[model samples]
Target: MKKTRYYPFERNRYFYGKLLTVRDFESEQKYFNDKRRLMNRLLHGTGVITGLQVIAVDDKSVSVEMGAAIDALGREIIIPSPVTLKLSMMQGFSNNEYAKNVYLCLAYDEKGKEPVHSVANAAVRSDEISEYNRMLESYKLFIREEAPDPSVFPIESIIEQTSVLYQDGHIRILQRTPRYVNPGQLFDVTFVIEKTLQAAKISFEFELVGQQLQAEHDAKVTFNEPQERQETEYEVTVKLRADSSSRGKATVGIRQDHAVLRIGDKQVSLSSARANEVMIMAGAVDKQWVDDFVNRSLEDSLDSPSDPCIYLARISLLQMGPTYMIEKVDQVPFNEYVYNASALHKLKSKDSSAPATPFSGSITARSSLRKIAGNQEPELNVTFNKDKGELNFDLGLPEVQSGDQVRTGVVEIPIASLNKFAASPFGRGGKSYVSAEIEHGLGRGSLFIYTGIEEINEDYISDILSSSERLYSGSTDVFKGSEHEPSGPDVKIGTVLYPQKGTFRIGVRLQQPTEATQINIRWWAFKKATESGAGSDDTVDISSLEAASGREEQA
Candidate 1:
């Protein structure tokens, strides 16, 4: 309904209360800003000369020289030759081909006593010396750690190129080759680079081909186990000189302090490096000890709860896991409902029983259960399509007394009814799909029937965020408003409320208003895979409805 504007420069100006306009700036200020911007663009653009260079650099000021030409009046004139071009080309253009003309004149000038020289040979020699110095500075920075003084020397670092190797068991090794020129002044120079690694090994070597030289290294790694939760270290050293000779060495350090290996179904504690992906290890131990442990954990599963809730919980544990053991279940705070006529005006489900309290109580619920429990849980088999934003519920009611009434609540199945006729396995937050099937019992006739899932208020949504355990271990919570709000409380019985997910329960108060009858209900689970997309890891399942009773016994 409303909007706000945030200015980027407001924070730094501190002219918080005062509105300032850039248009109010003086002409000189604007001119300076524009000129600064242009210079920055030209200097940063590919290969533009900055009019500075290094002939050689020591710990202090580096050898400085301007690559310019002397004019006819003996004044030095600077020229612009984009550095992206070759040094020989830059020299040729900067010298204006005067060196070639001088070479021709030197042949005739040597035989004459006051020769008419078209160009100066000294100028050509000076240009050659300056170009050589540029090369010397280039290689120093590129091949060695020696940095030419930026104040006097202007040589850009050579660009480093890299290549990747992905073979021999998922290893990703990168090799970088640095470009540099051979400085004729330097007889020799050494280079050292620092690297970090884990419990892996790496080595380096160098090769010289005529005037060209190169260095390389080999790193072999294994990731049979998860890398240690720590850091590792490594180093590389290179030696070079103007004679076109080169040497290199690589040193690796391994750390096994916190290695952990989780391959397929096996989880082991090991130490390794994050970069390593290959491993060589010893044999497999096939013993019943592991099987015995697994069997023992499942053997006492009956000691838990034997009710349908437990069955549902067990099924959920099966479908979704690392089943957490708790001393007692924590009940989220939900307000108990009393009949509200105004709110019920929004319940539009056609399958819901006729509203008796002048109010509708059909609040939609989305149940969440693990797929592994589909076989044991009857609700997992029932199918329903989410088409046109409408839900089709199958409400199957069992025989009951004339005065019987079904108590209603959020995720609360009548314990007595479940104990009597809950044929399907249910879990905490498990939904019971009551189809439209009518019950015909002793002395009772068949009634019109419908069954399946039901929809209530669209206000509630269930959020299952990633948990700290396995990918499948996540907690289910309810939320309101755009599915972004944190869950506040749960829905209370008899209260018109919305649940984030699960089965919707509506109390059907017969017109005769009896409380002595039975209502049988059944529900199943459903699942579907999520489509591929960013930030999503497929394999997501939406709950389904079905009817089959399963039990979970406590140990």
Candidate 2:
């Protein structure tokens, strides 16, 4: 309020106090208008042209000659021929502001026979027209010196010689022996050098390139200076690594390298070296045998008292090529075959051992009917020495009671011995039997036996004894305590049994009891009659059994 005498504001001092404000606004507007006009001219103006000429033309490419152009700054600039041609072929030029300006400055003549020229004119103080004319004259002279011929070509004749002109020497794989090979076997590959220009010392590198098999081999051979038109064969042996995982066809490549031919004092190096390829199939593992072996190993391990035994198993090599239906099946011995332990172990564990020993055992059968009713149950004791291959069994039945009119005898059997017997004659698919001879007993006696994948438990044993139709049932004759018959109705009956992979449980039940009862038991393995008119006997001499027992003790 101090008389409202505030000093004059800065804005007022410039706008009102300065007498040149109107002139400043007018100058600013003129400057903007000039810029706008220049932009419009650059975008829409059609420029002048001095000259345009074609340099050369061929099937593959075309060449052209061009002159200089004036840029937006009113300066003369020489645009390269390649840049000009590339800009002409480029797409989407209309939508681009800068590219549109360049297009306007490079507008061609109405007849399309002259080169595009500069957008700047004489009013812009640009001297590009004179410069462009001089450049055009020089370019025309250059084009005349580099012009293409005008003669026509005969395309048919030219195409006829294309194959001969491109003919060259190459190496090819001819043959592969034993196209199918076992995992651990060697592979033989043959290659041939065809139409090579010169004789060279060739060295080959063989490689099995695949995800499963990556094996490499190198071999060198000297080729006698090859004759003018003779083809030479080269052979190389490559060992395939043993692997079960590498199954099916594997890619094998053979590369020719380090080839040089010597002529007098000069060594001519071979060129255009190439590689040949062939496919070799790896053998597959027998899944059936593997499964059987694994199951047997596991069962044996569980049954062993000490450390598990490792049994050596044999695997047969499968034949290659066609198999005729009439071809006889070969029954080769087990010891002659090779086994794959790595594959077996991979399926299970390494704790298993081989089945090296022959099955052997002794059965001591005894019976009595004089014992009390509570003591009717039979007793059994079994001992097996796998290291020395010995098995012994002691079986005892209840004593007979006076005037009880019953005959009973016990027949002990070793499971290993039964398995061997079952596998040989029954052929692993047929039924097996146990035959026993009763020396002395009284009245009629019933017999029973048990065979299964697992051991015979007490409950299973009781169930068999209680059931009328036992797992295995038969009849035996009773005899006086001192009566011993070689062969008669008093003899022990043969009981049929099924042994799975040569393993089962054996049980015998004699209904009547006698004090002087003795039973001689043996395994009847084959279904066919033997020369002795009886199934093949599995009996061993007493002296041999003693010797085996001693050896087992020592072991």
Candidate 3:
């Protein structure tokens, strides 16, 4: 380790000296150069004189405004106030170079308690001191020439001060309190203003326009004020109509008008104009029923064999509007029922060894009215001719009793008549039906034949039963033979015995009934199995069987 030589005034010390000879010049030049470097480092590192602006300078002091900068450890170092420097210390320094540049830095260090000046008590040099004075004057002139005009600074300063001025008066529609409302319901509308005015009257006009109804109304309110800068709110209440004629979406609005404001004795007219439309729905309709009716009507039109009456009724409803006559029959439930007919032919078995032979069966049908009123009986002329395969029902006006409110009667035919008709040749083995028209004083009526089944037994008889009785009455058919009798083998048997049941229904609909009434007619039949023949194999030998046997023989 080498010995460390230290200068007595090296640390936190500065000096001002003159070059006496060539030999002493080196030490003095190195001393001043190190001092200059240290000063520059402190000025840049601590940011003390980096942005210093000279406010006023004199022999005693220099005024400056500057920001603090951080040291290496991030501690803030503030520039000392009232920076001052001794004029005699800056001797022989170049006026254009080091003197002008280091002037502010020297002033900053001089003001601090730290010993940053070089010539602690060195005697002053008169001529060099005068040169420093001339440099300082030159600096002052340069600063004045480079600085912007003082007038430009006042503009930015004024903008900042005026940015916080109070705002002028304005009115706003705060809210349409109840945007949606029902008929006859009251709704509130609110308005707000930044400041209140004396004798300020706000006028409002409300109008309702729709396909079914139209109405208009107006209201006004005046305000009393001490004219304070505060938020003010006003509310108005309006009501809708309470009637069926108000049914539909109606346009409701608040119309604007010129408002009058009084300032002392002078009247001022202000346009408080606002035009906004609010929609309000009123009245009530059975939307669910209409939707269901339209769906059912469209389905009826798309039916494979469409009903003409249903199609025509749908078109009429569309033209007349679904609401037409819907309120009258919305809650009414239509009546419907079914009647079935079948024939069973019993075959005789010889000596219980040979199988029973198959027999021919027939079915026929007709529909008619059933009943009229609950208690009051009406004269019904019904005719069922099995030979002619015809059935008719005529309903006559009932004799009015003492307590009767209206004349009403129900005409209906028996289910047995339909079974007899179905057993005829005309109704056998096919869908056959007959409808009848009935005239009554209260409502027009029509009878519909809803035939379920018409079948014959081409096999051995097993049992005979009614299909409607088995369905509606829950009655099962009973055979006289053994219950354990096998139906048949999986493979086709020569003779198979089984019982088959069928149902036929007849429905009579009466519109505009004067009283609560019901008409029900149902019939059922069963065709017993008869052994027709052996279940022969459908495949045949191609060589033995001819494609056209009749024409082949002629060929």
Candidate 4:
């Protein structure tokens, strides 16, 4: 498979299977401008210091000696010129993009990009400007003296290695390189030695960290501890002690130790770095309002002479955050909420041009309960009719405000509620859910909470299964069954059933559960089987069929 590389703004370019560097900071041009000239610079103009030695340091000047690259005439030469060094301690930029670009170029490229605006330019006071200029004037000079032979220089063998000396016996050697560097691009790093230490042969190792490096093709790093070798990527740091240290006098070799920063495998971009979860809560829709619009005198066409055959609802959602959860549902359960509220409302207002429903419900906290504190019963009511859809109730407690970090229950209403409402002889298959509006006298505010189909269904199933006490006695048993298996009567008062065509009110009250508890009423939806035998078809079956193996009904 081809590896996909991604650069946020610019397109990724592959040359000789390596990333190309933008070398010229003077003209501010990128790599694609002139590849051949840049290649020439890489072969000849580019030079590495085989060794580095800090001869001496005065108040103003730091004298250093280094090995040079060979010239085009096949003659080894020493370059004595001012090595312009830019210290970007904390450069100012318009945004992260500019900062990132400068950082990438300066840290990885031999010739780093220059800042468009100086830190001094953004300085508010006079001292800031003066300090910046003073630092700018402290550029070190690089003098290239023509020597007879390269072997004449003793420091030529010692590369640009920085040796740090501390006051104590401990020594810390540090080398820093850009975290990422393209091939053929020079990696500039600063190495510091904390204290003075004597070692004949010093070797260092470096590699990319984390999962970025693939295991199969990764290189192994061998450390020779006896030879006083320590390693760090781009940079290496060695710790030192306090007494009798010479850290300040340590010199750093910048070039000879460089190597090609390689990766085991090319990295592929991720589809997404992060995922988001959203929630939404909506008020109940009004059916009466839609009916009234249909009945309006101005437009006879607006009225539906007959019920629509196929209703395609287009519901516009109203929510605050990405996700809205129904907190509290009033006197009506979630099934009722949807049966009376959502479905009917949707049926009447299928068109976008339809007028707003007369009834709508909102979520509100109980006034008696303190925000974030438990032990309060929240309520919701639907009072709005064709003209209005609001129910105002007070817990007779203090007023509350939004963002109180209060914990509220999730009110679930099921789509089955809509089915149940449709089954009702009195109901026109219209909305059946209740809307509760909380109104406080002084310190509290009102919020709207709505139940969705899922919540309603879940709550309905939970209520039916958990209900311990029997409600009204309805049917009577017509016949009895065999005694061996103890078959129950078909019709009887208090006979548990999966209703086929009936309307019954369900109430929910949270109660503690105990083990070995069984029920006479069994309500289970059908599910599909998978390889692991796991999946739900969500088919509602109401029959007196035998239970599945290992799933027996309990009294």
Candidate number with greatest TM-score: 3
lDDT of 3 at 178: 30
lDDT by residue for model 3 over 1-555, one digit each (tens)?
011111233332335774355456556555554554343323322222233344323432234444333221112334444343332232322223111111222111112232233443364753232212111101110111011111222212221111111122222232232323344332333333222322233333333222222331234433444233222334433323323335334443333333454544555433433332333444211233244334554223222211000000000000122211111101101110111122112222124443443322221222222233435666666554333233334343332222111222223332222454433422122222222332222211221222222222234333343321211221112322554322211111011111121112244222222222222223322221122122311111221221211111100
Writing each residue's lDDT as its tens digit, candidate 2 over 1-555 gives 001111221222245566676567655654554454344323322121222232223211223344443222212223345422222233322221110011111221111234334564444545334223222311111101011111111111121111110112222223232334344333333333322222233333333333234342334333443222233233333333324445555544333244444433455443433332222333222332344344553233222112111111111111223311111111211111222346556755422354433443322222111112335686655654343233434333443323212223445532222354443322121223343332222212222332211112246754676532222223322323432212211222335433322222334333333222233343323221122232222121132232222122211
Error of 3 at 223 (Å): 3.7
- Candidate closer to the true structure by TM-score (higher is better), 1 or 3: 3
TM-score of each: 0.15, 0.16, 0.17, 0.13
C-alpha lDDT values of all predictions: 0.23, 0.29, 0.27, 0.24
What is the number of residue pairs that collide in model 4?
84
Off by over 4 Å in 2: 1-179, 194-242, 255-555
lDDT by residue for model 4 over 1-555, one digit each (tens)? 011111122334455766454332322332232333333223332222232222223211222344343211112233344232221222321221110111100111122233243553656664442222121211122221111122222122122222221112122333332222221111233343222122122333433222211111223332233222322112332211111211112222222233222111221222221111111112122342344334544232222212111101111111224422112111100010112235558764445554554334332221111112223444433221222222222221222222222212222222123354444323222223322222111111222222111111235654787632332222322222422221221211111212222112222211222121121222121112221122221122211111111121211
lDDT of 1 by residue, 1-555 (tens): 010111121222334575555454444354453444333322222121223233222211122233332211111223333222222222112222111100000000011233233343455453242212111111101111111111111111122223222111111233233333222101111212111222223232322222322222112223332132222222222222222242222112222333223333444332222221111111111122234334543223212111110000000000113221111111111111122334455553354454443223322222222223322423332322222121223223322112221222223233223454555333223222222222121112111222221222323222234221111101213323544332211212221212222223333322221222333223222212222223322222221221121111111
> Which scores greater on TM-score, model 1 or model 2?
2
How displaced is residue 383 in candidate 3, in Å? 57
Cα error of candidate 2 at position 519, Å = 89
Q: Give stretches of model 4 more than 4 Å off.
A: 1-53, 57-61, 65-555
Q: Which stretches of candidate 3 lie over 4 Å from their true place?
A: 1-177, 196-218, 226-244, 247-272, 282-555
Ranking by lDDT: 2, 3, 4, 1
